[model samples]
Target: MAAPPTDSFTEFQTNLTQTKAQSTTTNGNTVSRGPSPNRGASVPDNEAIGPESTTQQKWLTEHGIDKSKWVKLKRLNHMRYQHEDLNVITTFLKDFGVKVVKKTETERWYAGYGPDQYVYYARQGPRKFLGGVFEVDSREDLEKLVRDHADTLQTKGIEEMTTAPGGGSIVTILDPEGFPVNFVHGQSQRAPQQMPEKLVVNDESTKPRARQFQRFSPGPAAVHKLGHFGLVSAKFDVLREWYTTHFNIVPSDMLYIDLPNGGRKEVAMFAHLDLGQDLVDHHSLFLATLTPDSSIPEPHVHHCSFEVHDFDTQALGHQWLAEKGYQNVWGVGRHILGSQIFDYWWDTSKFMVEHYADGDLVNEDTAVGYGPAGHEGLAVWGPDVPQEFLH
Candidate 1:
């Protein structure tokens, strides 16, 4: 059986603050405090959400997480929000990588990420967590993404222009479902410099392994540009269709869950899809299953993953985690699909945070075809998942 609720919602919030203080010295940059606790009760969007006053750190701690483990709190690395329609949501996300090819405000905007990309989006009445945005390498990248994805850019109307902290320009648009979308460019107007030393990549092996394959050419660039997202939805089919049609995301594989006979006979294991980029291995997004009878309204991301330069960064994270006394859920396991070494830990909010290296890159000529369903699909090369880590 699922774990029963322990503390009241208010007590949960209090515990969160106290736990974070015990975790780390690095207090992440505070953004607009996100919506208050769900209060185990559904509420309207316009209605003041719980209390806007709470900090993300406090909220995260409430759920048994530590905030300092995250490497990029000061600069938002990624975001995920929700919208009513898939077309509208896809339109905004595509701005990050590919430009819209042909958009008719009447036609749904479904283009985003790349061919093998996977993204998570959820819908619940008028509220949603569409998707999170990541910090980019440069201003040229911002311009380039807009140019490439311009063909797919579709929006009903956009307003609420503002400036980001570093002078980055910000714009907000509504997806087909009425979710808010935000994009920023030319912030700080500075040249992309070396990412922090802690963020550097390291792979010293000169001899190539017989079984290991590197499909992509090496440079400062990586094949999989961004991270992963997990979206939740009651209508998984609708959200899944929207993602596949517009984003060009292919279904690499899916996971199904067998509920205790009282419920549906079988639901998917997490649905795994891939953004067809030879530059990176694994799907850019993974959608966990949700049924209509559940209390949550929409299917959305379970969590997101960031690409560290190499295994050295992963080592740094592991050491840091041990030094700080935070929990490690899984990994140092290598995934067969992406060929990336993995490590999983809980953040201040207890969301899974993945730090990885050496992911597989997929392109036209050398793509690996999708495989059949089963436990093998999730980790072509890792240990079986422990029960406590499944959630």
Candidate 2:
């Protein structure tokens, strides 16, 4: 998908540097004050769910995110997972479109056509969440993370990731909810793999391919890169504060629910990196709040999403997986939030993975939005969202 133009970072930062904002809260709770259904309500302090400024320089300063204090992440590197049967999961992944990078009896490394050497890591054993791996902008950025949570239980010294492809230094930190989040530095890049030709299409407004016919082969939607992943949490507020405070993560949209006494609870947050003037995916992570009375005993992962080339590529990929008898989860629709055309399926291990295309992108200037939490608000159009997909 085409991304928005990114302004020159050097110039943008130079023009807008200032002290960061202090943490602000409402009644000692999170920032999801119930907005009027028709319009956004003012959040406590200036943390309202709206873009306070249009320029990246202005947005950064407003959010109190300066280069030195915030750990700047370059991109989502990969996701690591463990399954009871390596062979079973491997077969499913191949049909799902990733090329194996390196495989042993117990471990498998997978790659997409993107610069990342590996995008998904699988290991044999019981089902377990290994963590979402990220590539930080600099070694200093990694060190900044170390300094932020130095004495916490989540702290771990950096170590060489010798066994993984594109050996790099990595440090693992557990979020307050005890899920591992890895940060890496200095990994070798991989060359791009061959991709399907961009088929020219003629729409009602534009006739671009006058003499050509569009054709495609049935195949797995070959992944381009790891786009984003999601998590469900009972401690949504705590998790939100930790991530938004420590990293350059800021909200694109914050979904909430109103309480009996006219209070507000943040039920869901979709956030993106504050890359100053650079354009990036509308959201890199989605966190949904687990209601206290819900049957789920603990927080869990929602799914891992990958990017495919276009609509044709995604449709073909969807058919391929269905023919292979994989259980379909919720998707083949356009999400209202990021506007991604999404398709999700379950791996042999029961973990959800998605292939999406044509998603929205934003810079720091994009406004933070607020909406109600409901299945009806999920998609602009698609098959009904599965209840199984929720909890």
Candidate 3:
């Protein structure tokens, strides 16, 4: 069967003709459009995110993670979100730079310019997250996942992905916290959609361009594909073990807080696929402990991040979303861990989505690094980290 006509090329360039607009302020809080006043009151710079958020400095140390078993995953495939209204989210998805792959009254799937058939999947109803999906290395791996977790609640058995845009097979497992994680083996692949070529830069040390003048047309920083996402789990230790031991994910970096009297507690981690000798993104998934001070009652996803071209594209994309009146959650900053220049926003459903650029990559040979937990480790520079964004 043929893939749905997503109008990938044409739709990516949509809204380019619309005149750029600025954000309007309501009461006093400046809602995320371009530049605004000093954000009213003085917000603290890089404050820790929990109750007495620091542990003893000595607790910061490196540790080895055991990767005993493996269910090989080729890469992250896509993410799913259940929205209150498909129409509203569809509108936001376009602004977020994912082209429509297929749409129905109750379901819609989106595609990025990347080879992955679809980058995001949405369902209509009360807002909910369906979890990120991964493409397993082989059908045998999918079989292993089902067989290994057969008796556990994680098992739902393998089934054909009939309704999906690109027909394939999928198996979704519920992790320790009941977060749904889907695994796929077979899916049709498509040629990546055409994108603007990379721009050349002339640094102080060297000048590359001699005569060509640089210019750009404002538009959404069209997405390349999904980058990475994070979760704050009440049962952090269990989930971390379950993921790394069961699947081929290993930590690249670990964040811990020192205890008052003795022990050290790891609060967050950045993990990558354990593809030996082959380099992959510094982190394909992130996990963090739910600090006792956080108001959120249960374990849940933090945000889903997507990859855009570079700084200029991300900036324009930020401008486009802010101009559209979407609330900025946090970002337009460089993170200390993965080194991604990130921009985050609250989607129509109030879930956070991110646009990121220039992330680091690692492989099995890269030794995991450890650090102390604090807001300073979050970003190297950008707008002040919003309090709402922490945790």
Candidate 4:
């Protein structure tokens, strides 16, 4: 592949326009736009790190896994955490755009403005990475998972999630690194909140709104849904295999670094839940391999991300967090792979959290891509990548 285009906002806009134009099609007398944009330009490559390769496809075929047997994960449901003080975490969550849906003496369920019943669940306890939650297609799907992997599943049987906002059945499985992975099914859906209207802009060539009155109050960016989360893992290969085999998650992109001998070793992966013909976010989960050269020695949750309204909402939220004295990580930029306008910050738990908007969506038809890993590979237009975020 040729070198990636230079990181510039102007180039991004131009490419976006070209992609939109290419996506339009006409049949008979009717014209319609495709569901996704052309993603060729989003693929990253680096001469310094070595040549890129789409090894994920070969790996999957070699495994000979049948898709019909894998558990169908619909989307990310919520993230669970254990905190010493619920009040502190609650305050932080509110500031981050989550509202308290239901609270008890021991547990609290916080929800965003989106359709999900809740986006985050916190309980009073010692700090612990309880793990992320995913929604499965049906109860039979969860049963099939237990029946097929009886030896590996952590929970003996499905547990009734009565305490949660949307009562459901849950089964927890432990990954190779002993992180809890919860799968839920039969949960009732919540009605979506009214989304803010998309703002109309007046460019030099075209002005849509005659009376322009756009005003925004400085506050938390209203979150739409849980987009994705990432983890730094020492046992990357093991966890990767476990996730890919158990669920219908496929790699959107892989990042590799040159090895000392000659070949390349994949160091990171950005994978999304595959719903076949259904379109979803580019990535619902990301995993970075921990190596000797890594800045952080231990395994940790890198970050959890939420989708917001749009560019203006993200900018105002970034300002809100800045004024609230939260430490910024890296963002206010567009990512090359996901094409999301992003802003990352350090939460009260010292874990990275992100607010993003205008992200690309794809289905199973999207091809997997490979790239080189580095600061430049992180974003196409943003402030210098922070050292703390890389690890």
Candidate 1 lDDT, 1-391, residue by residue in tens: 1224543555555665554344323368444433344333222211212332233233234434332222111122334433455464443333222233333433222212222122222232343344554333445444444554454443322222232223344333432333333444444422332442333223566554555553432212121234665555455555554444333243433444445675432233222232223333445555545654444455434555656656654565566565556666776677644456777765433445566676654432232233333445556455676543444
Candidate 4 residue lDDT tens string, 213-246 = 8888899998889999898899988888878887
Q: In terms of TM-score, how similar is model 2 to the real structure?
A: 0.82
Off by over 4 Å in 3: 1-68, 152-156
How accurate locally is residue 304 in candidate 1, as Cα lDDT from 0 to 100? 59
| Candidate 4 pairs with clashing backbones | none
Cα misplacement distance, residue 315 of candidate 1 (Å): 2.3
Q: Which residue runs does candidate 2 get wrong by more than 4 Å?
A: 1-67, 151-156, 292-295
Task: Please count the clashing residue pairs in each candidate, in the order shown.
Answer: 63, 2, 1, 0
lDDT of 3 by residue, 1-391 (tens): 1122333333322322221233457897656544322211111211212232222111122223444557888899899889998989989989988889888889998988888888999988887988999999888888888887775535358888888877888988788888988888789998767986888888789889779778988777788899887898998888887887788887777788999988889888888887778879989999988876676657889999999999989999999999999999887998877778999999988889999998887665455667898887788789988877776
lDDT of 2 by residue, 1-391 (tens): 1122234443333333211122348899655433322211212212333332234354446656555666888888999999998888888988888989898888999998888898999988889998898889888877777777676525357778788889998878888887889889999998767776888878779998988877677889999999999988888888987887778788788888889999977789888887877988988988888866544558888899999999888999999999999999976888878888999998998899999998888876567777788889999778998877877
Estimated TM-score for each candidate: 0.46, 0.82, 0.82, 0.84
Clashing pairs in 3: 55-258
Model 1: CA > 4 A from native:
1-77, 80-130, 134-156, 165-190, 195-226, 252-282, 291-300, 364-368, 380-383
After TM-score superposition, what is the CA distance of residue 5 in candidate 1 from its true location, in Å? 57
Which TM-score value belongs to model 1?
0.46
Better of 2 and 3 by lDDT: 2
How would the candidate models be sorted by lDDT, starting from the highest?
Answer: 4, 2, 3, 1
For candidate 3, what's the RMSD?
Answer: 14.4
